[model samples]
Target: MKLAELAKELHITTDSFIKFIQDFDLELSECISTDFEVKEDFARFARENISFLKNYQKDLEQPKTVEDIAGNISQPADKVAEVIRKEKPAIYENGVYRSSVSSFGVDQKLGGDYNFVYNYFGKRMPLAKRDFIGYRDLFFYISKALDPFANENTTLTDWGIHRPAGIILYGPPGSGKIFWAHKIAQIIGYQFKEIKKYYLGTSFVDGNETSFNDFLLETMKQEKVVLFMDDFDNVMMERTATSSVNSCDEETKEIILHHIDRFEEEELLMVASANTLTGIDREILAPGRFDVVIPVFPPNVQERAEIILYYMTKDLSDEALLKQILEKNNADHLPFWNEISARMKVFSNTMLIDFTQSLKKRIRTQYLKDNSLDIDIKKHLQPALREASAKLTDEYFEQMSRFIKDISVNNYDDFATRIENLKQELQHYRIVEKPRQAIGFTHNSDSK
Candidate 1:
């Protein structure tokens, strides 16, 4: 059998098979060609390794207490607890250990309502208003939409209470549109259902539109669901337009629109997100279809500061040390944190996260190179900050700024107004009156 065939039989990646070979001190060429035959001895070795890895993975998957893990691994419970505390601290709340809600092998039964909910959102972490750092008003608006049904007496139409059929979250890419959608679902006590592009594609290709629609409607009828469709523009693109690479066919577009229309009678909450509203079908955005359209802009100065602080120090347990690091970075002369945040006005949450991760990697690399037990925080971080700052040049900012402006102009006056108001709110929004020495430090050092 060829190396690729061997990898396929083992149900592992080709790169992993290469690594397995290297682990056994075998001198094999890096270019493991697709036609390279696997030796009998190596095939036996690979099978053994694969069996061991699968068993180890199964152990991890099974829910176990710290004591159970310690006993199984033949280590002290304290050591296991410490490892959990360092890695997955959220699971160690209230001095009791809990396992993460896993959804492995559950995607195959997408037609089942219960399995669909459990598979997609069973493991979602609980979120509060504060968790949605910058967009509190938007969060509250969504909450209000679901509040009527949440209360028994107020849901009566006689009392003039009605649930919104749909909401559109539009903005530049990397903005927290999808994140807020899931958070809204969690807050409103709804099972979140994400409708992927490929799901639609597969249904159409297999001529299963009716069956798929039935499955979706059945799921909605069974429970109060937050149905989310990301990249809505692609699915609802103008039927007449052929400019987009993945433009929706008229039949597919009509099917999606028909589903939106059904939301009028059903008590379902539909949330759709898009980077732009340029080419979407106008019917999908009609009043009854998507009741409210909101714009999610990039974070402002204070929000950016908070985002930076959150990502940078999320893993650290030493509150005093975290405070010192923040203070050092936000000092008057350097103002490293403030300056970086201000400079990143065009950055979305994802971009800011990636930049912070790069900075961390640089700091870690330098610390490792110096062979030091203690990190010289200032010595390594300042240069990384400067490098990150230099990378987001004027040209990049200008390009991103133009993209935001262009997308905000969707040919509808009311929609444009909402986008403008959002930008203004973010511009004037200040989480703190003045930049604090330490923005996110807490008294409870254990809290992440």
Candidate 2:
């Protein structure tokens, strides 16, 4: 199961929740043990005595007993009982925990031509169970992407050779499409190799089609390769000066088509991505060629929340922490999580503010409390007031005029101080929000 699913069930941080269950064996412990039940008195004692237990651990410099450390949980036994079904230790494999790794964009082309990876931003949706309206179709799409022949992967009898199904993801830049593909692949345990859709499509051996054809045939013979082609748009559009859109160019297309057919016939998996479908020659991705056409777009709220939880795995995990991380970062949860997981230190809270409408308004309230937004300044900043009052949106952007009204500046030194404060505010916003831009989402306030 995905981490977010478990996190939601337990209402704890992903790291904490996962560690307690999968890593620490707490979840399994309860399943196996029938005799043990936490007593109310015992729970209270544990809660009240946590400070002493911590001090004892500090003094002893080693574990004294299971009860000695109180499961590293400082609250009452009831609290622990509430969070975990029960506490029993189970041994976990060493090296089970690993730091999250980020994939820098990869470059691969179908032939020797297009250099950049085709970009896509797909919605990260939860699995569906019918009764649809508000439910986005991305989950079904992901299931298909994960198992290209998802329906067919269950074949009972062998015909010739059964190559496993793989997928192709193509879409617009900043669409966050490829990331979703990677996540689905991760869930299913497929080794991923991102190919930048670069193809010279330049003729070989006096422009004999055999050169590229032979090369592609050699590649097709390799096993378990997804053959992810990015930017399929550039090569297929017949943009090459070398291959004019003539009959000979059509022949070049044939060589390419033949190899793709070979991969399909042989049951080898291939996923090719393109930003603009029109750029791609229709013959390549036509019905029998690629199995499915999955369109990826920027995340809606639920998908963004799932991604935020995934990224914040290294930081805090619960609703509270998620809210904080979103607010601290000041960007929507998706980009913040994507960026922070890169440098996040494990343990305790990693900062993010909640990007939800309610949470953002709460944050604004906190800001108002922290600094005085007095009546005089409010009177002077009528335009700012009008702008902020313009709608019932959860997002509220206080104008710079309000910022200026509050500051009493006298000369250059004071101005510099104000500038420094402004710099800090802007800096926090950048630290919080820039990653959204990094992963290709627009950095507008609406994104939050």
Candidate 3:
């Protein structure tokens, strides 16, 4: 490109470009020397300008020292940053997880009465707020265990409450164990931590994971309590089904047990959970180690009904029905009542209703120019007839009793009519009447 063209691209006047060129003792044309040469001066011109160019180069290339560089930034930035980093550790990284009141996500509707049921158990309850069964005993154990630790390590903090309990709850998955564990931190409004055990594998500075240990430890010093050592189970998995399934993975269970053995008391209360503490290797579950160990089991029928009632919408009366189902199920350890599943009563009606609407639309589009299935079963059809003779006979019971009495008294035609009415009644139950929801933890025959 021409020297003038280059100057225009640089947003310089030809005069300014000449001044820049003059600093190196070159004319506008001379600055271009041979057109092919990008950065060189003609020999005679360079001989005269060499000293000036060297001085200019020296001025441009001289670098700032460490003190000079530091001075260039806002003053006292180091002190300000140190304060913030110390107050809230630079190591903490936050993420969100989906949790529920009962540990398993409860199927509930928004803006409904059932919402409270989930919330009732969502927050961590304090000594003051907990209403769940066994809470009083758990609190007592925690207080007694922490008495020594609190006496030793706990110092004056802004909040009067001192945490002395360091607990590990291990049980079957989906057994509401973890939810209860984190609720401790949640109850006191403290940060809940899942210790990155990978960080504690060896001395930190080996890599990112281990380095987080240095960060996590510092945060532990400041926060009221945090759940750490995020490895959900270190020992229980060893003897359980998982040890075999996951044997290929790195890290022996010994490392985890070792960490628990060597742990120092911090102000933070640690909470951990696993499926079974029985196999957790005694090293980890030792008295000073876990402080307390509590096990959780599935709710009994009454408890299950309470939970179900909490989620229900229709509030159907079903006392006898519940009795019948419970009596049958109580024979063994049944996991759940399929009859009480949320989708049960709603499906058949929804399917039938949606089916009829689509059928109507198809009839309108395919057959009629004016378009519609003229014979609409969804709207007009009521109940269906009983196919089984036994069911027919059962349906005709009240009428049958009446019929038999009438016949005995010699009224045969009326008896026959009564039998027919009873059969009609039986047909109504088959028509798929809307099932009333059993709002409470029950499947009662009576529509409560």
- Superposition error at 272 for model 1 (Å): 0.8
Candidate 2 structure, TM-score to reference: 0.36
Give each model's whole-structure lDDT. 0.56, 0.37, 0.37
Q: Which candidate is the best by TM-score?
A: 1
Candidate 3 global CA lDDT score: 0.37
Name the top lDDT candidate: 1
TM-score per candidate, chains pooled: 0.53, 0.36, 0.32
| Ten contiguous residues minimizing lDDT sum, candidate 1 | 101-110
What is candidate 2's lDDT per residue for 134-211, written digit by digit as tens? 112344335434433432444324433343333445433444456655545443444555543223344445655544
Candidate 2 residues lying further than 4 Å off, grouped into runs, are 1-136, 145-168, 183-190, 197-215, 238-253, 265-267, 305-448
Clashes of 2: 42
lDDT, candidate 3, 1-448, per-residue tens: 4344543444433333332332222222233322212223333333344454343333323343223322433334344333222322322121111110100111111111333222322232221222332222233333333433433434325334333345765433343555565645544456776665455445535453444435545655674655644344542354545555244122434443444433444556667765444344555555655646554333323333333322221232455332332334341122342323222121122222333344334434443453332333222112211111213333334333433343334322312333333335434445576988768765565646
Off by over 4 Å in 1: 1-130, 144-161, 203-211, 241-249, 319-336, 373-448
